[model samples]
Target: MRLTRRRLCSSAIALYCLFSLYAAYHVFFGRRRQAPATVVRGLRKGAAAARDRHGQAEQPPLEMEEWNPWEGDEKNEQQQRIKNRLQILNKSTKGKTHISVQIWSKAAIGLYLWEHIFEGLLDPTDVTAQWREGKSVVGRTHYSFITGPAVLPGYFTVDVNNVVLVLNGREKAKIFYATQWLLYVQNLVQIKKLEHLAVVLLGNEYCNNEWINPYLKRNGGFVELLFLVYDSPWVNDVDVFQWPLGVATYRNFPVVEVSWSLLHDERPYLCNFLGTVYENSSRQALMDILKQDGHDKLCWVSAREQWQPQETNESLRSYQEALLRSDLTLCPAGMNTECYRIYEACSSGSVPVVEDVMTTGSCGNTSVPRPTPLRLLKAMGAPFIFIQNWEELPAVLEKEKTLILQEKIERRKILLQWYQHFKSELKMKFTNIIESSFLTTNKP
Candidate 1:
């Protein structure tokens, strides 16, 4: 009986010890397991309460790993700056103004200005495209482009207050059309039909623009601003701004998209010159020099006796292909040093070996030390090889031979980048100037 009682006491003691260990395990470890869930429930409740108090949903917590990798990238920074500037522009000029781009010239220079500067901001249309009435936030100021007088009726219905008349005053007959357009617009302004007027004039190659003075605001006329082409001495950045003679859009020279091949591809020809070679001109001399050095064989040279105003598709394609396949474009002075070829070469990442001598024109004063021939290009620091005489062409070509593929690629990249920057900077400046002058208050 005593032995049986001893065994029962020992079993009872073991059971008590086991129960204590189980209770301790639950107190220490099991509570830790439940604490996370309890804390999570409490946090969710707190978030809900905060939202209720504020009458808005709680913002999501930022992820620990989320960050912009391109924070230091120059291209990204430029894009951001442009985006910010655009935002400012949009916000400031919301609905205070309405403008129209009236392209009066069929000239490539006119098309170049319209396509590069205003086309992106305005509704895309040609000389024949009909106008529509609507609004969007894509551009700060609303603009409409028309090529002919047929679309004037649409502007009348929309009550467009501001007008940018793009005219080609390059020749005597062209100047007549420009004046007529001015008179028509002046009549509208006199009738209080239009609020503001600006002119984008492709001035004569020689820079004789005295005829348009009577229609300027300074002379008690309506036109407030003038964006003139060529190296006009009158580009004071106030009333008149120097506009670039961009690529020949009339010849269907496209906005060449920068590609790997355009920058790095092995071009066959060392240089190219495909245009009308005038008799006893610098171009004639250039042709002679090229042949004398037997560089004509290495370069793509195509010269015609008469200058054609218009280009055929086949001819234009061939010209563009030459620009693309050649490393350098030989830009001899035509009527002016600044030609469509210079800008076109830039589009193809081809360097322009320009004949930089000032032509006999009223463009600038020889008395003053101002850069006459290509003043705007010089000011903007165009990466072009400028020579006073065609005799320097042989030396330039000889130097070009020493540059390897990698060096050429780097140069092409710089040229393309610079050209794009120039266009964008001009676009922004043009927009800002218009807004400042036309709008009574930028804040809307």
Candidate 2:
């Protein structure tokens, strides 16, 4: 009986030892084994989530915050670095999404358009200042100006899918060159080498742009868009839009940045007129009117019988100075009612006293349309003194004499503000149009 009781106790001890070993293995080795399984399950769940996201449409880019230039240098630098990093990331994510555009222009007005449309950016052109290449002021468009038909072939390449040709098709000679440029691009398009083409044409002072019909996109031509100057009846704002004849860049008219002095400083002259007087034009009549009552003495009048296409340094300086120092700019009608002087005066914060009567032209003729003359300017609400005849000038100048310094400053501000807004709106419109049209059919 004693031997049997001892055996039972030994058996009980052995069972207790086995249970302890099992618990130790579970606490160490068993937990280690379970950890790997848990990790595998988590990885599998993450992979499933990734696959789900991949199946859905791509998310849009995050909105960028506005940057303040007034911020301190250190903060600005840090912010700029962050912005650059984000831009790089976005570029990587987008994967070559920006559209590259090449602009070609030979005319001086082209430079004017370039200044406004590109927001006053200028890269050095050739020695003649007729050719240039650079990035634009806004949007994804890139511009490369070519000196004209002679340089068009040299600059144009197969890789250049998008193009903007600024041409002066106002006369027979210029129209011929413009036609040659268009035909060359058309042929390229026909062979599927070029994707898109647009034109910023300087239409005739008479609004006679019928020569451009063959190259219009609406007429089954390669040109996708047409930005025509002058108040042409063809302006539809869709494909054919009215482009403002801005300041004369050919004469090196600057993109004037307004200053406190330009606004506050009192102008010495009540009026100014530095231009050619034709044999029998209203300009001569304007001169005659200014001569009466010693108005010419009060005003800065530099009139020449012969018209000069190019301005000498002295003449240009004198002209600019006259504009800067005068409260009013006399803009008598030459061949056309609209002149570069009106815009040039606006740039200098000088009020334009324009001859509003319609000049002889198919566009300005009474039979054509009710608002054929100065339609664009009137539509834009130009704050200028428009007179039917030079007879009204004395009254206008007399009123101008009565205006105080503060009144002139306010008027100047209004003109400058309007001009700035006009340019900005045009820039945005031009950018939007190109992007929308070019992106869908982007070749590169």
Candidate 3:
């Protein structure tokens, strides 16, 4: 093999090129085990992180801010303040898979009206879709709140998902939206893309629906009865003669109010501000007091209306500080009993003084301590301080401010810890619901 220098150089270059080609082939065709291994490692890390962040019921209170209130200057006073902050509301993260929607009318009363009732629906972990069908089908869904597309029969024929459809309308749309939509979709409903038949059921009222009655007479063998309205007055006396959604509401179901929203399983919201709606409401009232007496500038949160629509929440840094510092936080049920306030109060370890006044004059017969709302403020775990009416506020809060602060701090600690551990589970639960609803219809 001894050759001239030029020949030797040529031979070496040839071998080098041949080896490079082989390496390239291996690179292209070789197994990609590394990629899969990387993915698995990531998942393991995520699971471990979740487990660590969320612990048993006895986990230490989850910390949101860097400086612990209790550990700050004036240790005794700071700890007392931290102890009193109520963390009764729950908190969860919003994931991807949120589908955008466009409605027909801008002036529709449905936005705020239905929003008040159905807010935080998108906060779930499920696959949720919104449609804007402009007044197409008359009396399809009774709620004028549903002035959107006529659900085009079968458009909603999916299983394991919560369907959120908001419409534009005028007048008192609440009563009619729930009642009418039930009737229209039952008859006119059909799956547009998929092939699933909607087995619609009225969870609230078990009226004898002849459509499902006869449909069941014929094709009942292939349907999953989905519940549209679920209330005792409706579900309890529901004529067995009629098809019901899901084999009767789950025994453990809380019978919370339902609409196109919140009825579905969803990821918990990142931020929920539970404030009293009245002039000088509970959150503000406490904030005002802290500012006046405590000289705490952190407690200044803008009024609910100060936030413009479509504005993403940016007040968390400050509001959280306020909650961490304040002696007491009120969660009186009025215009503010919705999800945001509950989550915010809970995550920040703020004790929410839950007042039982209705936010909307009429919230469909909903169960108290709803899952997301209760995730932070565990049910019956610590003192909930539930006030049945407005009159009792004086007597309950009459105790020394120190005593009141102590009571609230205890509750906040319990709730924030609970939310941290179970947050992932709670998220999965909500997402499953959306998946079920999106893929199925309210078939009878």
Candidate 4:
């Protein structure tokens, strides 16, 4: 190899260019190939320093929320009053009072009964409009005016439920207040030793309200019976209950396991014959109607609690008229109590053919009425009967028919008299209470 100065220089230049390209490649990609030991040492030192400085307070753990029972609806005075009134009425009556707190509320029913009683002694249309408004035999308004506290006064007014108080002087004054949450006589039962029912079915919603059956069963009433399909508050909708023989089974009670709504499930027609005013009380249930092929003046009608008058119908007037036209009035259960039919029938001077006319709800906790419809019927000389079924209906009706008119008149007299007596008793009680309250207030 001959070495020249220019050739030597070119070879040196080529060597430098190749070294530069190799350094560039190493700077971009080869750095990741292995970290410098100094860089790794610095990062480790920085992390240790940061941890040592901020370790004073520990972090808190996450927390959870709590639960409450009365979350949905707030407790109010109205509810309190209802509960209190029920307690008081139970105490004062020593567990007496029935038609169960006015059939809805003791106060409302008292007032209603008073109006009817007064009207029976007088006339609905005869009074002045203003007077009529106050003393009208019937009312149609519906309001949610809470029934417990405020004007109604709670239980210990030694107070009362389903009671009407005439605030003024005596019975001569006027009714000023009505109590709520009443049901006195409803507490009594013909308990026949019951345990748990197989299944309770309410033809209505299966619910807490449809608990009458359970209450009966628990109280040694229907010990051997199980529930079948029925509508009640607990279930979702209203429908007939049916169960397979395999799925449904239970022991039988010595007593009949009948629906609480009717006197007898099979013999509702017997209701017609048990009592009568101007009619025979000895006819077979449906035979009398079929025998006469029915009378135009004496008609039988069936209605539910929620009946509404239409454009052509008689409105609320028809109900009243129907009652007035008949010597007999038949009532059944729907929408809680007997509904308007009870008053409508009573107002028309008609005898109510009810299985449980003397019954009420369990809200009041009062003792059942002592002298029953039978006793009262005897007193009024009214032809009234109580039957367990339809088979005994017609003969009873036929026997009582001749005297139906007479008994109808007498029943009205008795109802009015009883209402007056109630007013008298209520007045006396109120006088004592007011006197006591006024005296007590003046004492201190």
* Least well predicted 10-residue stretch by lDDT in candidate 4: 244-253
Root-mean-square deviation of every model:
12.4, 14.8, 22.0, 29.1
Which candidate order results from sorting by lDDT in descending order?
2, 1, 3, 4
lDDT by residue (tens digit), candidate 4, 278-347: 2233223333453463531234454232333331234334443444445666543332222334434433
lDDT of 2 by residue, 210-305 (tens): 888977878877788888887677887788888888888778887788999889899999999998999888898999898887889999999989
Better structure of 1 and 3 per lDDT: 1
lDDT of the structure predicted as candidate 1: 0.78
Q: Any idea what lDDT model 3 has?
A: 0.36
**Would you list the rank order by TM-score, best first?**
1, 2, 3, 4
Query: Per-residue lDDT of 1-444 in model 3, one digit per residue for the tens?
Result: 556888989999999999999987766555332333544554565567767777522322234112322343687777767666533221222332332122211222233222322222222222122443321111112122232334443344333122333221112453345335434433433433223233333322222233333333134432333323222212221222111121111111111222322212221221123233456655555445444543233233345635332322344344554555443455554332433444344445555556544343222334545322222233325344556554554454444233543454455556655544444433343234434443333344
Per-residue lDDT value at 345 in model 1: 97
Error of 1 at 277 (Å): 0.7
- As for TM-score, the candidate ahead, 2 or 4, is 2
lDDT scores of the candidates, listed in order: 0.78, 0.79, 0.36, 0.33
lDDT of 1 at 87: 100
Q: Give a tens-digit lDDT track for model 1, residues 235-312.
A: 888898888888877666776788989998999999999999999999999999999979999999999999897878
* Ten-residue stretch with the least lDDT total in model 1: 131-140
